[model samples]
Target: MSKKRNLRPEEIAMLQANACMADNWSSVFVPENFDIKYVSHTRFSGEVTLGAFNKEFILPGGLKKHAGLRHVTLHNCRLGDNCLIENVQNYIANYDIGENCIIQHVNVILVDGVSSFGNGTLVSVLNETGGREVPIYDWLPAPLAYVITLYRHRPQLISRISKLIESYSKEISSSRGSIGNNSRITNTGTIRNVRIGSYATIENCTRLENGSVNSREEEPVYVGDSVIAQDFILSAGVILSDAAKIVRCFVGQACHITHNFSAHDSLLFSNCAFENGEACAIFAGPFTVSMHKSSLLIAGMYSFLNAGSGSNQSNHMYKLGPIHQGIVERGSKTTSDSYILWPARVGAFSLVMGRHYHHCDTSDMPFSYLIEKDDETYLVPGVNLRSVGTIRDAQKWPKRDKRKAGLQLDPINYNLLSPYTISKMRKAVEVLKNLQALVGETSEIYYYQNTRIKGSSLRNGLALYGKAINKFLGNSLIKRLEGTAFSSIEEIWAQLQPTESRGKGEWIDLSGMIAPQEVIENLLRSIEAGEITSLEEISAIILDIQKHYYEMEWTWAYDMIESVYGVNLQTITAKELIALTEIWKESVVSLDELLYADAKKEFSLTSKIGFGVDGSATEKMKDFEGVRGDFENNPFVLAVKDHIVKKEALGNELIERLKVIL
Candidate 1:
């Protein structure tokens, strides 16, 4: 503890005159050489520390306001230097207001009782009824929440993790809250049990209760006019403005919630933007965005997902309550007005373009299209591999990461095709082949899970799925030997040796972080045994596992080759490698061609119809060129063309090298 100081005679007189009554007036200390010129109309009680306030503060638009109290009541609060706190409608209590903070026109600010600022608040995330409630904290990341929300089958593990958080929250619980340095709170209605971080800008917010704003200088969080939040943790770089209502939520880093968007019991991760929509009991992973006004995301798990206008889900049947939940994997999208009845699983990087009554489990067939045809759902598997939209989305997500924190909490894996999704595709191919065998190959349409897969669609889907699998395997092989100079077959075999046995089985996508399932199990076992406790420690383990992903992936992929592709690697010939390379080259070129055609649609004549209004044909053409530019010259289009050329060259170069060895 620091030494206490005695108050001077004039300061004691001022303290006496202001009706300040502490254990001792001399105990109400200030910094040495503290100025008293700005001390006026203030009441202090209990053990209060006062910094000098005799400084002129510049107001907005060149106006100036002197630092002095006027018509405000404070109880057990410390006033920092140069702060302009005036006109409090009610009272400010149990707060340690930091230096240069401006509080004006606030109704009431109080700690009330011991509070952890929304820490350990139970958010019933995946299931609202109870069993999967995640105790939200200021540092809660998406991948950690994913484990807590979904891995409830391991009860001992969940209990140990929950115990760690509970103890952490207990340690930080206090009767006093802090409004951080340089914060400006004006025209706020009520702030109760909230811990505002440094440089936060809370202006005109109607109500803020039971939350922690984890703002910093590098990434200042903003809560603007008429915003209301309760039992929430607004992370660094978050902006909640324009009447957004958040309750029982964990808003992750760099998230933007505006335009009166409402969310309850949802965990929105990094870079998710929610505007004019509603989300309830949803687990929104990294980059899950919904911008339209009429969209509603409820009781689902999603990552890298975009909910189009009027996109909605139903978790209830008339027979039971809203008990069902769904998973829309990373890079998936729903078209305008698309709806899905819950207990459904949409695959990774898929496109859902229509309402589907039947609960289709497309988890095994990623990169597919779910379309409605004549009130029946049509499943075109693996078609999204060629979609320009998928390619564009993949290209943009990395560039769009808005997190500015030096310590990133979420370990994101952005691979479009990894062992996680490739394994699913391998299963899907078998499932489709089984369907074709069960129902005669000449059947006009085959039925599975109450959806129709037409004969031609099935055939094409099989071909596309095969191409994708071959591309992934070949790409993995090339990447594994990218820098190695294998002069002999023995050297090539040596390069393929497994470095670790950890990745030998299934792979799982825990929201955005993909790793081998065995690794996750190992983590869970460790958590159950109380080996990893801190949030930072848990995140470090996850990142460490993700760093060794490729080695584990090869372990899984090596076993998959014999079972799925019907190839034994121990007895493989040079001709098989050449054949696989040729097939991979074809797949890459075909998909690039498909993407090129799809991209061209963006700059088509129809796209230019509205660009040049009230102009002649040549003028309209010039106007279109000025704005949208020519199709072939577009940067993405050019990149696609270049990618095709480069990939072809790479494949040919490898093939020529392989010929010398053969």
Candidate 2:
């Protein structure tokens, strides 16, 4: 859309004197405001547009490279205002380099044909053989990826969804790549068929081909030294550095892949980090961290997971290819040298510390420890309920979110005691009781699932489960009726009734999203019917579920309340409510006291041995105090102690308020 103008004959002659050549001189179009002082040694052809180049740029070490082209060839390209293109070993073809961009020392930057810039690229995730491929896009969230990749049982729904993504990819396909305003690409190897966003810094990258760096002025993208990525969509604020190699991966916002880590066919969502490790065909949800060089995560689904050194899982036996997959639920950790055979599910917040070949199913026993002794797997159920590390992990995850993207791709639930894990604990309690009842009480050991449980461990597990259940139910009741005035028994009962009935079924963790099964069914119905079109709308639905988790959780927990207490909640009296509240207070305080004692072990005398190097014993004590602070003054330890006092006050206050009606 331009008013036609003829170039002055003298000006055209001056341009030819500046070593500027073109295959067809009439095809080159320059704007009316363009100043050609810096146009030197440039060749243009095939409907090109040149912008005003009137600025001097100071390069590295204060060497000035003025705004123009030098020893570069452009074909079917648009050069915007104040851009400096120099030292291109090969030509940049079919591109629109934006204003104020500096493209130097690049081998080639071009687009061969119509491309979607990695959107809707079939990333063969979770299975290396291509049966399960997720169509990756710029707005692909983890929950949607989980449904698309894992919900293969409903083939029609997946097909319908895949067709939608394919249509979107076709709609966005283009033949030219773009470099946005104020971007910098220096000392890079090769960039092909990629869309670099504004203010992005691409330096020393070996190769970045067929990707979309969704960068912006607010949060730019950084592709650092020797990074090679292909068929990827890197969201804003992500760091790809340290020779990390990736293929067919979706690196979500604020994710870090560094230290020569190699990933293929994986979906790494927001805030996931991979350092010196390897991941293949894995679905890594938010906060999935693997820092050890020896760890390998392949064909597994994980969230809030920490893989220890030499932690591994076998997805294939000798009989078949890598077809098997496992689920390590959220907030789970593996100790050093832990291994698990595939097709097993570990419950939430559980710790796996040893190798197991029996394929033990510990999904019913959460917050437990699975250990290996003499080639036998021992299940110490509910041990994590008393461990200080579990509580610390719950406290730390919320503080560690690093995503700066305006729209978060993962809706993370950081609750320590949700229906997802509490229901499992309730099942564990029943399982322990069943073992005790079926076998004689005098039995020294019992076998359940594939792991052995000693008598003492079973008893301790039952007790711990009871305490945890009481703690959770109490928390629900207190939160539901905290500020309400319960004048009589009927008022207290009315408060206990759920505000909504949507949560009265099984709960599930869809990658990072926690919601009821009915909601998931509704979402699938909508997707099948073409109601959910944009990926952002689907993400909105997931966030709505996460925000309403408590209301839905109450419905699920209420059904279990009647069975656990053996009382009808509708006719429960004020005295019963007060009693439940009292038991809750005791359970909460007891757990807090145990956590306080456990935290003291870290600051004991044994921990002081290495603190004071070349010092006396008294000096060692001082050194430990100075370095590690006093135990009572430690942040986590003090928080635990203060928690007991605060809960005691809250429980007594509630009891006092309820006693008046009783």
Candidate 3:
């Protein structure tokens, strides 16, 4: 607590000489060593508390100015030590400015009345017509928000979650806002009820109203030129700049929205980047990126997605308002000029190309391609299993994670071959085989779920799905038995038993989290029963599920192995295990070979056409190699070859060790 003392006669004379005036000098409190030398042309009204301003701030381009109040009007404001507030256009009212902050050339910053600072604001996400409104707070996790948006069948759960957030909002509601320490607000206009955090830089923002910029010393938030954000919560490590317009949104940690990107009623989770695009009522999960000017993502749910130029979606049909929504599962990509009508669901790791007006649901066919030709939707199932782009995307997401500080609220599982996708692949294998059996293998075109599958595509899909399934199961098996020693069949069976049975049936990718369906169901049940009451509790539960993912995945994989291979683990011998190892090796090598060939396509003669415009074929080859490097030495190609060698050696070693047990 700072003490209020009367200004000395000499100090009052100096302040008056400096053109500083106070409505009531007795009502203002200043430190004993406070100097009126640097403070001038300032008017103070109501209650004002001032701290010592002795430090000098160095500005850009080698200019320096001492920290003090100059040419500003303060109304019931408290200025901390070593802060500079100069050239306020309107006034700053009811703000507790922190130490070492610089508020210069601001139009008006005030808290007019009690404000929740964007908390408890209902953002109508997913479905734009209402009903899926999530009351966003600072700590809203993706999984919790996922439940709130999708689990509307459980009304009690929704009510409980809403009340929890609302209660938290009420607790933090205040009539006076605060600017944190080491923050800088320069050339900003009309910042109303915005609670900025420490080390934040708000520079040249057009308008920021009713939001919480949750910046911190470790990862400061940056709000730059021409940005307009309202009813939003910008999380730590977020950068909203370059005329970005955000409304009724929650921009999560490490998210960068720039280049005139517009987002409304959206929740963009950690590590997502939006540049020159527009998003409305979207639930963009971790690593969702859109970097094109013509991209419009609306009323959709996506995670680990990459939207190319002119990629858009239509949520409104003609009858109802913008009420429909779509879900593109994790690791999907929309090629240039791709569009999808609402109420569609794309499976994980799929590629969508061309416009599709039909609301096709390809949720069971993971790693496929949905193409449009002459107003017909063509589905090529499981071909993305061998796509170099899919492999590159999976390899890049972990390296591209930009959340360097703060607790990551969204639990992202960056596995390219998780049980979620493997389960879908298994279903796809069954679906394709069933389609062939029912429609006859001689049929040229087979129809399933509003999409046409060619006969060759069906056969190729079945083969690709088989290879991927074998790779995933073998990977899980090798990991499970990596260091275990089994001398007998009983020993092997004991080691192969699942650690838990809860992960046997189904799995789901809840935004970015990959978990067993049973576990999610259990958590939802707990929420419905009021066992989970707060946001923190729900987040803890979701993180716990993420923590034990591998163990639960083994549980799911063990059952899948037995079902797929027709093996009775209780009676299987070392010879069977060795055979499984051989199959695993073959699958691993085959997929690696496919990836290698795919990489080679990038270095082909056709790829060298534009490299050497005025040179011969030899010069074009040289130029292409100079830019893209040799195919054998490329990082991805080398990694693919290395993976093949390591997996073969591993499988051989495992087979030999199993033979010893026999």
- In every candidate, how many clashes are there? 0, 0, 0
Model 1 / residue 511 / CA error / Å: 0.9
State the lDDT at 180 in candidate 3: 91
lDDT of 1 by residue, 1-662 (tens): 12335688877787557644455564466767665555556665566676666678888899898876666777778767767888888989999988888889999999999999999999988777667899988887677799899988888888888888898889889999998888889989999999999899999999999989988888899999899999999999999999999999999988999999999999999889999999999999999999999999999999999999999999988667878898998889999999998988898998999898889888888998899988888988888887888888888988888887486767788889899888888898889999998998888898877678888888888888888888788787666656655566666667766687998778888888898888888888888887886867887888898788878888877777666667666666556767777888998888788889889888778888886698898888999999888888999999999999998988887777667668
Clashing pairs in 2: none
Provide the overall lDDT of each model, using Cα atoms, as 2-decimal numbers: 0.85, 0.86, 0.91
* Local distance difference test, candidate 2: 0.86
TM-score of each: 0.94, 0.95, 0.97
Tens digits of per-residue lDDT, candidate 2, 119-195, equal: 98888877887889999988787888989988999898898788877877778789998999999998899899999
Candidate 2, which segments miss by more than 4 Å at Cα?
1-8, 54-66, 486-495, 531-534, 567-569
Worst 10 residues of 3 by lDDT: 1-10
Stretch of 10 with least lDDT, candidate 1: 18-27
| Cα lDDT tens digits for candidate 3, 152-176 | 9889889988999999999999999
Model 3: residues with Cα > 4 Å off, grouped in runs: 1-6, 485-491
**C-alpha RMSD by candidate, in order:** 2.5, 2.3, 1.5
Best by lDDT: 3
